[model samples]
Target: MADPVAAVAALDEPNRRKLYDLVARATCPISKDEAAAAVDLPRTTAAFHLDKLVEMGLLTVVHERRTGRSGPGAGRPAKLYRRSDEQIAVSLPDRRYEAASHLVTDALVEAEQTGEPARVILNRRAYEWGADLAGQAAEADASRGPASNRVTEALARFGFEPLAEGGSILLRNCPFHSLAHRHTELVCGMNLCLISGLLDGIEASGVTAHLDPSPGHCCVRISQAPSSRSPSVSR
Candidate 1:
């Protein structure tokens, strides 16, 4: 996993950020020579910055014979750089909009097929998805295999950013922040059901999910016992 802080720090340099922009905007991989010319920098400077980006996991490199010439004089292969698939997010505290996207999209599809209310389908599917994800994680980590471990990892992988807080795992980020802000009732409801399903899927007898909304924190929090307190999301 790429360190979020380090990834953001790498782009703090002006020239490095410029070079990254060039490569990212390009239709295809760019060479050091091309990048330098585009940014009005020397070949060596561009190469240095490009390599730095690669090291930071912001870009990927490949050796390409771009000339399309075949002979002893074909010359050395050119080094090319392109944007990496790695996602770099530096949300203050942390947030997970992508996870929300996955849940909402899947719910939409499921609703279309079943001819059911979107919210209801979202509730059911979110739990099923969490359970399915836990199963996959368990299979992938057969060695240290405990359902809780797998569940924790799966949540982290989805950018939940779970952190220990007072005998509870406080979710530090809500992947669906914008949606939650606009449709607090609907989104938080989906979130609660989704996490509840996650706990069920993992067979986590030791922990339970609770709806605990706080400013700048995830709406759902995981605690050792299910709380009688139910958080109301405005519909």
Candidate 2:
């Protein structure tokens, strides 16, 4: 019911990182020992941190068992910790995305002024970051679902944190977006088309990328388009 982000904030830094570290790494949910192992904290410390998380409603005890020595006589199993279905989230800083977007968009704007070919500029970026893309390709080879997973992973490689949501994904970090005041149309549209192309290239066809200012999110919107579509990539 309360803001989860606020609750996480209420914690100390190491503790806060511990919590995010849990949600971030959870594959099929986790138990107490699992969470503890995630942060490399002592069992007691992990239990303490987990108790705080439980109190804040971020976690709930699923089941309990007893654990003790078994030399003369063994006890029951030990209780394990798991995350609650409930979740509360915090907003990412828009200024960061906007600033990064500003840089790339500025380059694009400048390219236009100097009459540099557009495709050449875009390809130049992709090539310049070839190693980064190669690393992401290797990561993508490990997952399933639409190309979005790989897209998110690649973006992560590029330093943006993306969260998976319904059909669409949330970009917690934006490496672009700052030139809004000056290069509004070009920069925004460029990012949109760029993401759309990325999705398309990943075989996630029919995915159209859009920037939603209301919730401050950018994501792919899969929908049928007119017969003709431009091949130019962006963002």
Candidate 3:
């Protein structure tokens, strides 16, 4: 199948970004005109690229529907375009993640060699510190009414334009789930550990987690700590 990332890269710079954004936001198929408008490209330009996207199999025309008549009794309705699930598969085929991991890893190395007595342990210490904070918050005296707007407040802190849906909040800003792809359980545990310390009752359990590596998107679930009102379980 055509690589979504590669296909996007093949396009011109700004247009590539525009296409990625369009694919990300559009839930269903769009027409050439709508796709053009979605990317803010001129009609002719949009049309040209739309066909290119289709040819690349990065997008497909899903459905066509009527637009309102231009006159009292206009001709046939306008055609609509949409995105297809078959769009390109964007991935980090390069060593970008490895390079980033090394950067953080090297930071740790430098501290030990040059910094003060405890300097070598910076980022690791930070992660631990952050995890401790998460654990505490989990065990805290925090309260949230289930019927209340739970996500609206949680996402505000994360700096995401939060989207709420049926008791769930989606973080739209992260286009990929980078952390989780490496190790599901490990990342989840890290998240839980940090969040727990950040909350009320929970303390650092130092739990070793088993994780599956699914290199796509990782989900970070944000919820209020389990209330004391509920039946308690062993920490």
Candidate 4:
């Protein structure tokens, strides 16, 4: 699991946080001396804090020759630092507003082009996005030893706090709680479809997703597949 807390905590120190902001604001990777001059700190002080940020994964370090020469007189290569490409999200209970935004954005684009209803497009796009996530998860799992119970890990990774309950997995948190509260029918229906697609993408045959709505819980629940059921999601 990505630790948002660690990333956030790393920025608590005032000078370290200032150095991070300076590097992040730069259009390109910056040298420690340049960073020190901007922030009015000694080069050694700047290097110390900048290295700490790199250690925390907030910044990435690379070595490059500042001068356009490669001879002995060109001097030593300078170390450059820049903001890491990794994204940092710090939701207290872990919300997935980005996921909601992606589905809605895709829906709008497809609806505009295909002349389909926005809601319909939203559902289809959401399912596709979920499947893409599952596909990526599968690839990652393949590289890290044999596959185990990835369903629960996948759910948790996507911010749907899954709780194992006998043969079923109950979702404790809905990443789209605020949106779902306002538009329960639409959001819940979309959730069901997305999870269904995820299950199919992961190729888990014995388990299935169902629409088991309860207050303060996700609308979808995963359980052992029934002998017979409709191809579509149930309410």
Candidate 5:
């Protein structure tokens, strides 16, 4: 998937954004001339912006002969632009609602098949998924570091935004913020289990995952395990 930030930034230019809106609102693919006329831009300038949008994955391109005649007198196929099927979303602090939705959907399907509680399946699957994320991070970079630093680095990439204060790693952002607001108990429980599984998979025995909820932050926090009391900090 393309970076959401870059994809969104591509539309920051006025002419590019206007051409995008024009093409997106059209029922069928539109040629550069049609888009330029609709948006009151020169055909060449509109074509440049349209192609840039295509490169950014905001639009897709196809060539088609607009004229009915094809064999003898038909001109070359006109390049048409349309909105791509890619879903682009940018959230402050980087929320992962889509990931939460997929987990919930999977749990529902499995629960229906096995006659197990959806919540149970959700918590288990979330933990497994979290562990998988940590495992992938470990595989990507094999350097050894403090447990807290490893946890912070792993969670940061997943949009948890972990911040170290004194001896504990406080998560400043919850990836499933919106879902957690509507279903606090269920989502928070799943979050706790997920972080716990991450700690387990990463072999971060020096730290423990806790359900310490506060406003504007993730419910999961990592603290130094009592037996391994050592001051480790990271941002």
Candidate 6:
């Protein structure tokens, strides 16, 4: 996978960014000479920046003969540049809306084929995915300390930004922020199921996941189970 941060940083230079835009907008790959002329830069300068973009995985290079000739007389193939197929995204707080979108799409398709409710399918799939993630983490490292710590580590790995506060785990960032805002009930319910599955897969005890929405935070919160909560005694 291409590092999105590096890809974005590669465009920070003015000439490089311009060259990238020019090549991306073109219908076909562009040669170094064409790119230099279009950007009003020297050929060497343009080539340097273009190659840098290629190094950063923002652009891909191809060598093809501009002149339609197959014999030895045909000069060395021209170095052509074009936008890469790699998808680069950088989101603050590390949202995973793309994953959520895929899950929803799969749920809709499965519901149509199996004649099941979309909501039910989505929740079940999300739960299974969460459990799979936990299982993978456990397999990666068996000795991950206590259940709470393991759960927090898994949540953080998935970009939930879990924060341990008092006896509850408050998710500081929602991996599906925009979608949750638009489809509050559906997305939140899916998220709850996912976390619940993670907890179950890891065999977490005395902790229950629930919907506890607040401004600027995930809709779901993990807190002490009702039976595990201790009553306050009068002094």
Best candidate, TM-score: 4
Q: Which residue pairs show collisions in model 4?
A: none
Candidate 3, 1-235: lDDT as tens digits: 4655667665666775576458657776566677677678888887776666666666665443365447666665555445546634444432234333543466557667777433223324334544454444334426643323333443333233445544334443322246545654433444333233322223312211112222232244333333412111111
Deviation (Å) of 70 in candidate 4: 7.8
- Give the Å error, residue 137, model 3: 55
Whichever of 1 and 4 has more TM-score, that candidate is 4
lDDT of each: 0.78, 0.55, 0.45, 0.82, 0.83, 0.86
Candidate 2: regions farther than 4 A off: 1-135, 139-148, 219-235
**Predicted candidate 2 versus true structure: per-residue lDDT over 191-219, tens digit per residue:** 55555545544554444445554345443
* lDDT tens readout by residue for model 4, 83-158: 9998887896778888798888888888899888888877777677778988888877775332227888778878
Q: Which portions of model 6 miss their true places by more than 4 Å? A: 70-77, 132-150, 197-208, 223-235
Candidate 4 global lDDT: 0.82
Ranking by lDDT: 6, 5, 4, 1, 2, 3
RMSD of 6: 6.5
For candidate 4, the TM-score is 0.80
The local distance difference test score of model 5 is 0.83
lDDT of 3 at 76: 55
Error of 2 at 157 (Å): 3.1
**Candidate 6, 167: how far from true, in Å?**
3.3
Q: Give candidate 1's TM-score.
A: 0.70
